[model samples]
Target: MSAIEASPAQQATVRMAARALGRAGLVHAYGHCSLRLNHDYLLVCAPMPPGLIQREAGVVVPIRGELPDGVLGEVRIHQQIYARRNDVGAVARSMPPSVMSLSTAGITPVPRHGPGTYFAPSAPLWDDVQLVRSTPQAEGVAETLGHARAVVMRGNGAVVVGATLEEAVAFTWFLEDAARVECAIRAMRLENASAMSAEDAARRATTAGRVIERMWDYLSAGDLELNSSHA
Candidate 1:
């Protein structure tokens, strides 16, 4: 449903998704996310920083054209993807530190945790370090993304897409976890450090999708739920 037509609950879920991504360390103050409101439009958060996003902060806008005040300049990224990919329902752009680090280093993240299996064997890199503010740039990045779940923007961060909001959030979380593990391995200088095989990753992706809603429930509950689990 379009954000203009979304229920209070749906809009609230969108807000929660954004904040949860922030809490999971997938996004910082600068990045943005969007939900495909309908076939022709997406509901994107305002240009305000990530952690501060509220339910009312979203703006329903067309895929292209002069952006509304407070709309993100990089809404073009969300716009172009929604324009080109018929199956996509949600998109998230984040600047998680580890992911951005790997991007700058020209290293693609691989599955290190079981959740990491949700990603492709290697997330494609956009290579361009500029803000994705133009249609051609957005289309090129979307092309690099292809059918992959995620793509890394060199010197920027990563963008994840999904058939649903839950899946997008799941990918964002797993992407950062993979990056963290990759950085750890690199830090240790393991000459032959191995990542999960593509076959294993595919198998895990299937399993992860089945339980993604549960995982999202746990994650969205914040650290109190996590702390209680360890208590």
Candidate 2:
């Protein structure tokens, strides 16, 4: 697949998404986000902490080939995922504190709240603590994600996907909030706390009424780069 150049607007959006994840505390010094340019290529944030990426244009890499020099090793996760999931147009690698803590105990957040419903019954657990730096490992993680919106890596972090970059960022926040609810319930020893029924979750898991757009606005509200652009 031939690489495509990411426009300045696309680069800005990717940077803003990275900053949003960092500002929301969903990621710290080890996370990334990418926007799919098409089936053949994606534009990933610079090889730095997502929060600190400013004025740096993203790297455009082919979805099916070896990662270009200067791309992070873990970016292979994005590569394999884009290769497998055509519906996904963006991907976020985040490590929300609550989500991370819960996954260490082999638990993925259950849909106990409205935000949780976006993940439906629950986010799948990848059950691995290792970083996804190898082709086979990345493929395995993407396979575990399946058609789900997110996947929790055991004691590592998570991967969230969406039809757009903004939606992916919003889902990262939603996943963290769901984890927060689950952690609170478990901490209170609420063994009887009921998770949303499958039917109920299906009903509640919607993007109606600008739910995702509102979140994206909130997260990107103060982003100077994004605010300065008309894209």
Candidate 3:
């Protein structure tokens, strides 16, 4: 009952993403994560909470088609993009507290903080967390992310995509970090807005990418047993 007919390596990446996001506190038990097996196909997690969703069984759904289970509405956004572009591989939807809270309050993450944060001068389709109402709405959203890392949903949360699960999870981590930094900076009302400039954010995106590769290694090794850590 697994979704999609993917290689063991691809499936392992899916499980790794679930565990890493749970550990990073992005998942709850209801949120969803998916990887594009190909432009017309993907592997979706079962319906459940963000942190607790399981892959033991899922509805292998295909684009240009429909499933009896009905897809998550939020997934419409990702599906729309995959239907149009072949560049994106993994997509995740989660309501991380900081990003959620910040979006509601109209706060912005300053990835300009350093080379570990993922924000930018050319990030795309996002300014103060623009929230699109439907899947087709994401078409405009993708236009903005033409080459940036991720995009935020105004007052909702975020949808992060990358070439691999590891890349996607890493973006999610820094997205949170950027949020954390913004929260702290605002609480203190510090005058270092320049701390979040564009140049620094791109640099950090690069560094964060490397850090995530190391994590991908640890995750792929099978020594961590991440599933039990959550149980």
Candidate 4:
């Protein structure tokens, strides 16, 4: 059991990520997010109804095990990712409609905006459409993901990883935006939907760290607004 308990601040970040991603339509009742507590254990959003996730809702789940009550079965996804990537501190499994739609097709999102540049060089598309349930399946996903910030699961959605919960959560939205823009452009049948040049993308990539931080702040505020609206 590699999973361990999360600190109070880490738990708060996990909850915020869930609500922010849900409010942004990047995830729903079916999807989930997680934060690595260390090299072993992870804190994941326990299975629950849709909407905002509060601090108390995060579950400390092991990398491999009989899951605790409320923990999603797909936890292996996070476990395998963390096991494979020493640099990853957070992971998100979101199913945004646009990202899902684009995943099933041959289209790949390029740097179309500042947010899109977070993926910089490019994003990988995982051809498998099957759910990541078992350890082997999750391991497969990690392989496909490689060093990419995110990977589109064919006929599924996407898996995003980052060095922080904030970055990972921001990536969920940024990746969705990229997919949405690509889909919109495809719909228009643009003759020249030019992607950002490598030089420009490289320049933008240099600012990705700060960009994700700001995006996290902005999205967390949006999550608060959604909370207030529901109040």
- The top-ranked prediction according to lDDT is 2
Question: Which rank order by TM-score, best down to worst?
Answer: 2, 1, 4, 3
Scored by lDDT, model 1 comes in at: 0.78
Alpha-carbon TM-score of each model against the true structure = 0.88, 0.97, 0.78, 0.87
The lDDT values for all models are 0.78, 0.92, 0.62, 0.77
lDDT tens digits by residue: candidate 2, 39-113: 799999998989998888889999989999889998999999999999999999999999999999999888999
What would the per-residue lDDT of candidate 3 be over residues 26-50, giving only the tens digit for each residue?
7675466778877678876666664
Model 1 Cα shift for residue 37 (angstroms): 1.7
What residue runs in model 2 are displaced by over 4 Å at the alpha carbon? none
Which residue pairs clash within candidate 4? Answer: 2-40, 2-41, 3-41, 4-41
Clashes of each: 0, 0, 19, 4
lDDT of 4 at 211: 77
Model 2 scores worst on lDDT over the 10 consecutive residues at 222-231
Candidate 3 ranges with C-alpha deviation above 4 Å = 1-4, 67-70, 115-117, 122-134, 138-146, 207-209, 217-231
**lDDT computed for candidate 3:** 0.62
Q: C-alpha displacement of 86 in model 4, angstroms?
A: 1.2
In order of lDDT, best first, we have: 2, 1, 4, 3
Q: CA lDDT of 8 in candidate 4?
A: 63
**Residue-by-residue lDDT tens digits, candidate 4, 1-231:** 333556666666777788878777888777888887766578887676334566455788776555666566677778888888989999989888888888788455889876678786667887887787777887788888998899888888889999987888888888888888988988999868888988887777654357776887787784543343223
